[model samples]
Target: MTTNPQETTPNDWDTRSPDVQADQVAAYDAMRSKCPVAHDDYMGYSLLKNADIKYALEHPEIFSNKVSTRHIAVPNGMDAPEHTAFRAVNDKYFTPDRMQVFEPQIRQVVKSLVSKLPRNEVFDAMDGFAQLYAVRIQNVFMGWPASLEQPLIEWVEKNRRATLAGDREQMGKIALEFDGYIRALLDERRGADAAADITAELIQDVIDLPQDLGGPRTMTDEELISLIRNWTVGELSTVSACAGIILAFLAEHPQEQDRLRTSLAVGKTAEIAAAVEEVMRLQDPLVTNRRVTTQPVEIGGRSIPAGAKVTINWASANRDEDAFEDATTYNPHRSQENNLVYGQGLHVCPGAPLARLELRVLMEELLATTDLIEFGGANPTQNAVYPAAGYSKVLTRIS
Candidate 1:
């Protein structure tokens, strides 16, 4: 379904103003019903409807992922055969059984961070717990040195801050620095002839597949470096942001918090898990994913030219009125089988299992240990307009 450019209004871009943020759910409802495939520079070609997003993710060939560095990873960029190989490499490390091995370690990381809190006093969960814990956990997964964790965290912070500064050129420079760091790690892993971690495994084991893009069948140095940088950014940013948001939600809704506490009391980890999904659905940290048209296609009764960029606002689709009941409200008990937070179809987040593990462990720790996590100071400012959906300063009071 294509939309007429003349009829497509700029009013559709929900750019997260205070008013917009407050009514994002309402805005998405309107967009999905009235303008499912409207064009706007801010949101690209908006795919607000759940069906539309589902369609887009399913047909990766038409809606190609190979955008510029503003988006990274050859897999993230590639459409089909290329995308498959890269994703296969990632799945090698991110398998469900492999992630399950780290459950105890993830719990320890979460507990260790929470344990450091000053008893019954105020602190920023974003910094003291969420960001710090996310960084450490990421290191654990990647088999990176613990010593390098702070520097990597500081680098991502700088990259995010540069984006918030509205400096695209500066953001690129920061990205180069990040890529350089990944390259150095890749080099070390390749040179060292020893038992290696996942990162090392990627470098040593080449994907023996068709290479339409370049020379070798395997991932190039640049591609490997790119994947590492992208994985780190995606993992660190989303987990940190979601952690703070969940804490904020729990802090605001003591009734929900108590429900979680009592439910966990009954040894019902299932209930608590359901609550996490609800929180993820309501939070919906990611705004949208961009896709480029590889061929002419019609959507919403209008024709989009080949090579145009499209944006599927998952944040909006997760709140689609047609798909969700009272979409705005935080309903933890809301059925998890339908939510669009982790996206749908082929492009559904492969890191989802690890993300669930991390979220579960953190929530369990909060429920088992703390009396309450309260917002004491001003709300944390969102870090960026795209990708990294999180707080700038999230001050809090936890007891």
Candidate 2:
């Protein structure tokens, strides 16, 4: 879309304004009820309504995901036939059997960290807990050594800082720094037939390319690196955000916390996963995803032209009152059919199964280990600004 057309639309709302930056979810909610398809230079055309966002998600042919071509993003940055071939290979890594095999290692990671949260002392869950858990689990899945954990965590931070700064040159360097890490890992697994991790699988995995392209062949290093980038960013950023959100929610809501603990006592562990999803729906972790309209289309009574950029507001859409009754209220048992937490249709987060496993195990361990968790410390937690979602800090104390 960047190659074909540009965003010439006038601003309907200012996404960078103090009002929106202070609280993205609330601002988007207001936008959804008032002007569902607002536009800004930042996101171009923002889709705030559930129906409109779903329309874009389900109709990827019309609402293309290929928003840029300057850099590769594996299947996510590709469209249609090209995306389908790469996505097939991507989907295989997170199957039920794979998650099942990965659960014990995930539990080990969860336990090691959860044990470190000081009992009855104030701490930022995002600091010592959520962020570490995200990076550690990623290392576990990728078969990367623990020695890489601190470096990867630092890389994610630098990447986020670079993104928010709009420092492309620094972002490029940070990206290359990450690529070097993965390339070194790839080099190690190149001929290790005994390789049992997802990285090794990707090394040997073949993408069934269409006849017009090339026949089935192993993914190139560039392709593999891009895929890993997608997976790593999603895991580190959004998963940590989700963990912080869930922990913060439980700390603030004692009744809900006790109810979940009761559910766990009776072995209703699935409730932990349900609670994780429901909480994330309220304060969505993964924020906006971009698409480019392939043709002129009408959305939310607004006329959009071909080649205009579209931003799908997952946070707003999930909390939309029309989509779910009493939408803002937490309900773990509610239906998630329309939930765009992982997104919808094509380009949905491929690592969802692994993500769900990480989060569910994390909550299970925390709730099972702690007698109570509560909001504490006088320091006010800040809302993560636009382009970054979740709390910058979640102050809590465990007991």
Candidate 3:
């Protein structure tokens, strides 16, 4: 199809181009049709189809997770036995029992945020509700003070900007700023109490590292800070994006909204959770995850050399037409066993249970409290640029 330049030369695809940034999902959706794998300067090789992404996830060895040496990303940046040890430490926080115990707090946070929604007024849900929901729940989880709410929110926004601009210096400063916040918390918790909150609880948890590096030792402050940053910064931005996406979808599709509300009334939580997963599959909250090729590899009929960077395009993979029947339509009942919403394999999000619980509780609370959810009709929504997925500004209404 010489109709479009993108179809002719996939490598020329500029992720930072104006059209692509304006609506990433639409751009990626188009990319999947013309090219399954795309390459550009900023994002490296991008996997646009579900099969290719799953292939990479299934074989982490060939596509290594250790994409950078400049900074430590705790488990997200670790690979193999090292990743295993750190991952075990990460997994304990989101266990079934831990999530069960933490459910009420999630409900409380959601209910509190829901109660504050302005009725019959135009408000930006991204800033007013979604970000608040993510920040407050994160605070609840870590026993962080309410004072940190605004700062964390601000930090997330700044982090997004820095990341999109590819300003490594600014990102490094942002990282240190976050580490400072965690360091202060650690100081406050020192000898004050054990397992006071998840952050404090981490003090007692030990990573079963290799014997050469002092096996079974507690994580250092730096390591603890890195892990906590993964838990907080990663959660806040993406969850807020997810909340915005879900709320906007509800606003636009009254039938599905009513269906979910009724399902909530009947205690059809499994249905609601399935709906959330399906919606996320429609519009993924996280964009790309990076990996570096351990050796030269052939993927999707393209030859990629060793140590080359790879960006897994969750936005595209989740929306691939080949992956789901009528992939663009919203249908919760269809099989979603292959959904890459939270990811797959070893690095499959350790915090998924908590994320699911939070979203489920949020939906239950928002729907139960409001008779309807719809657009504010005063302002058009803004789609977030790359490095962030979902709405940047959503005009929402609740009646």
TM-score preference between candidates 1 and 2, better one: 2
Ranking by lDDT: 2, 3, 1
How well does candidate 1 match the true structure in TM-score terms?
0.88
What lDDT tens digits, residue by residue, belong to model 2 across residues 1-399? 245243556787888899998888889888888889998887888898899888888798899888887888898889978899999989998899989999999998899898988888788888867788899888888888989989988888899998877799999999999999989989888764646778888988988998887888999999999999999987899988888888888888889889989999999988888888898889889789888888999989999889888898899999999999999998989998878898878788898898889889888888899989887777637798767799988888899
lDDT (0-100) at residue 199 of candidate 1?
81
Q: What is the clash count for each candidate, in the order shown?
A: 8, 1, 0
List where candidate 3 sits over 4 angstroms from the true fold: 1-10, 193-195
How many Å off is the CA of 170 in candidate 3? 1.4
Predicted candidate 1 versus true structure: per-residue lDDT over 145-218, tens digit per residue? 88888888888788877865578899888888888778777877877473478888887767745745563466
**lDDT (0-100) at residue 123 of candidate 3?**
81
Q: Whole-model Cα lDDT per candidate?
A: 0.75, 0.87, 0.87
Regions more than 4 Å wrong, model 1:
1-34, 69-72, 192-195, 211-217, 377-387
Which 10-residue window of candidate 2 scores lowest in summed lDDT?
Answer: 1-10
lDDT of 3: 0.87
